[model samples]
Target chain A: MKSMASTSDKILDIAQSLIVAGGYNGFSYADIADAIGIRKASIHHHFPAKAELVAVLVDRYTKQAAAGLQSLREQAASPADQLQLYIDYWRSCIENASQPFCVCAMLASEMQMLPDEVALRVRTHFRNLAAWLTSVLRAGVEQGLFRLDKRPDEQAQMLMASVHGAMLSARALGDPGLFMAIVAPEIARLRDT
Target chain B: MKSMASTSDKILDIAQSLIVAGGYNGFSYADIADAIGIRKASIHHHFPAKAELVAVLVDRYTKQAAAGLQSLREQAASPADQLQLYIDYWRSCIENASQPFCVCAMLASEMQMLPDEVALRVRTHFRNLAAWLTSVLRAGVEQGLFRLDKRPDEQAQMLMASVHGAMLSARALGDPGLFMAIVAPEIARLRDT
Candidate 1:
């Protein structure tokens, strides 16, 4: 049982990275096999189809994102600080090339080709992230820590779009610094009041 | 010769749509063949390789984008109006499901998997766009019609990221309205000053 769980975790990690680096069709089972040094049959045993594997991968990502937000909420003293931490986390990811961009956002750009189940999982992630962002922005607004010309949800959508878009620009321009340069000011603007 | 040119143009059109709908590796020569009612061998005659096909596609897209921005510059009266029309172009694309999202941005997310030539073309598009946007923003600032916290080039990066990012959110959320809802505020903020 322990070995099975570990194998499953390993598979998800590989899939997540592949999806992040490319898109839905960018990597194949053979690619995964080569990377993990495992036979194709073993992968089949874990995930019957590519869709099943991707569906699970997206679900896992959604949960991890939510958990990260939850931990930030618990650890931070203010909503503004929580938002800053979130930006910093993504900034570090972009800078180190540890995770160049958001997997959900990457998948989101390729939504048309994703399996229906996997696509739904990706949408669920955006919704959940938007909700979390709105919650933080709303709290900040009510607490008089942030100013808004629109609703929290609207601001969340804008900020989410900017963050993901900044990653694209940074990767495309081959300049990791561009991500923070684009995003930090926007986050600061939210609290400029 | 004319027919051959027309066929080549048709292939690029279909390939661009497929790339927008999915990513770099999403479509195949067979898919293009099916779309244009041509044989794979014929597609081979035109493109010869997937990388070559995509390279030409990216090049064509870059030119079209540059042309679009150019026309807007000549026709629009003010820098702010030029920016508004730019946002409106993307918003209309998203609303009508025409272009929907920027193909260069889509390809940017899948940069690591792209052929070197194709990836370079994608990067070229970004650089050209940033240059055009910076030009517009600088004109706006000089005209005293807009305000920016960063240099025009940096502001251009933020605005470009936000525009492309909004498209991702709108698509992921299955709501095209989200595009304008997110972008309008940022644009308005620029002109608000």
Candidate 2:
């Protein structure tokens, strides 16, 4: 059972990199087999089909991301700090050339082509992330740490959108600095008391 | 000559829709041929190859978008208004379902898979758009019409990112209302002076 679990994780790591590099439709089991040095039949034995493979990939990504955010929430002193930490995490990811693609961002871009099960997971991830952000923003507003002309939920959506957009802009320009430049003000805006 | 121009435009139209529906590698000449009721040979006759087709598409898209922005700049009374008009144009495009996929957004999502020429064009589009946005934001700040903690260039990038992010969020959720909801406050924030 342990061996099976490890293999599953290995498959997921490969899938994440492939999806990030191309997209949902740009990869196939043969490509994964080549990268992992496994038979196509073995990939099928684990995932059964492309949709199932992506569905599991999305699920795992959302789960890991949620845990990371939860940890930040527990460790950070305030909502504003948590927000900065989140942006900083993305900045580091881009800067290191590791995890250059956000799983949700990649899924969001291929929303139309994704299977319904995969697409639903992507939508759910956004909703949960947005909800958590809304809660944090509301807490900040209550503590007099953040200013807002709108509701927390609305502001949360805006913040998320800006982050994703910055990722796209930065990647397009081939400059991680561009991503930082775009998101820095947003972080500053949240820091503004 | 006019007939050739119209055929080229048709090819672009089909390509854009396919890219939006999938991504850079989503479609082929066969798909475009079927959509436009043309022969595969004809598509090759016009485009020579997939890379050339997308390169021309991106080039033409940037030109038309630039012209649209220039016209908006000439018509608007203030930089803030100009920026708002720019957002409004995207809003209208999304709302009317006229152009559901932003060409740059689509390209950005598949940047890794794109050929060098197409990738260069995508990068140029982003730089041009960001520069235009920076100028508008600078004018607005100078006019005392917008309040921003960061420099205009930085703020503009943030705004651009947020707008694009909102589009992705909205599309992922399959809700146009969500897109507007996310961008409205960012726009309102600029107006808060």
Candidate 3:
């Protein structure tokens, strides 16, 4: 049972990286096989179909992200601090060449081609992230820590888009600093006095 | 020669849609052939390889976008109006399902998988866009039509990221209005008194 769990985790990790690098159709079972030195049949035992595998991967990613966001809420005392920490986490990831892009964001780029199962999970991620962002912005407004030109939900959506867009720009430009350069102003504008 | 131009245009049109739907690895020569009802050999005759095909497509897309922005500059009297028209153009695209998404933005999602030729063009598109946006923002600031918390170039990057990010959000959520909802605030903040 222990070995099975590790294998499943390993498979998901590799799938996450592969999906981030090239998107939904970018990698295949054979690619995973070569990377892990496992046979195609093993991957099938775990995932059955490519769509099923990706759907499971997205499901796992969404849960992990939600947990991380929950942890952020618990750890940060202020909504502004929470937002800053969230940006810092992604900044470090991009700077270190580790988990540089959001898997769901990458998957979202291929939304039109994703299986319905996979697509639903991707949508859920955006919705959840937006909700988290909305709550944070609302809290910030209530505490007088941030100023908003739009409603909390609207600000959340804008912030969400900017963060994801910053990721895309950083990757495309091959400049990790570009991420902060783009996103810093987003956080700054919220607290602009 | 005229028919040849139309055939090439048709191929680019289909390739753009396919890339927007998926990513770099999403479609193939056979898919293009099937869509255009032409032999794969003919596609090869026009674009030898997928990398070359996409490189040409990005190049063409960049030129068209540049032309459109130039036209926006000519038609709109001020920086704010130019920015508004730019946003409106994308808003209409998302709403009407005409252009739908930026092809370069979509290809950027698969940057790692993209060949150097195609990747180079994608980078060029972004740089050109950032330059155009920077000039507009600078002009707006000088004209007192816009206020900035960051340098014009940085602000351009932020706006560019927000716009692209909004497109991803809109598509993922299957709500075109989400584009404006996310981007409108980015614009609104600049004009905030």
Best by DockQ: 1
Return the DockQ of model 1.
0.90
Q: What is the DockQ of candidate 2?
A: 0.81
- Sorted on DockQ, best first, the list reads 1, 3, 2
**What is the lDDT of every predicted structure here?**
0.91, 0.85, 0.91
**lDDT string, candidate 2, B1-193, tens digits:** 4455588789999999888778888888999999889899999988998999999999989999889888888999998789878888778888877777688788887888889999999999988888898888888888888877677777778888888898898888888877778877787787644
From the highest TM-score down, the ranking of the candidates is: 1, 3, 2
- In order, the first chain's TM-score in every candidate is 0.96, 0.94, 0.96
Worst 10 residues of 3 chain A by lDDT: A1-10
Error of model 2, residue A162, in angstroms: 0.9
Question: B113-141, model 3: which lDDT tens digit per residue?
Answer: 88999999999999999999999999999
Show model 1 residue runs off by greater than 4 Å: A1-5, B1-5
User: Per-prediction DockQ scores?
Assistant: 0.90, 0.81, 0.88
iRMSD per prediction, in order = 0.7, 1.0, 0.6
DockQ for candidate 3:
0.88
Error of 2 at B155 (Å): 1.4
Give the distance in Å from residue A169's predicted Cα in candidate 2 to where it truly belongs.
1.1
TM-score of each: 0.96, 0.94, 0.96
Instruction: Supply the TM-score for candidate 3.
Output: 0.96
lDDT of 2 by residue, A74-144 (tens): 99998888888988898999889788879878888888878999999999999988988899999998988
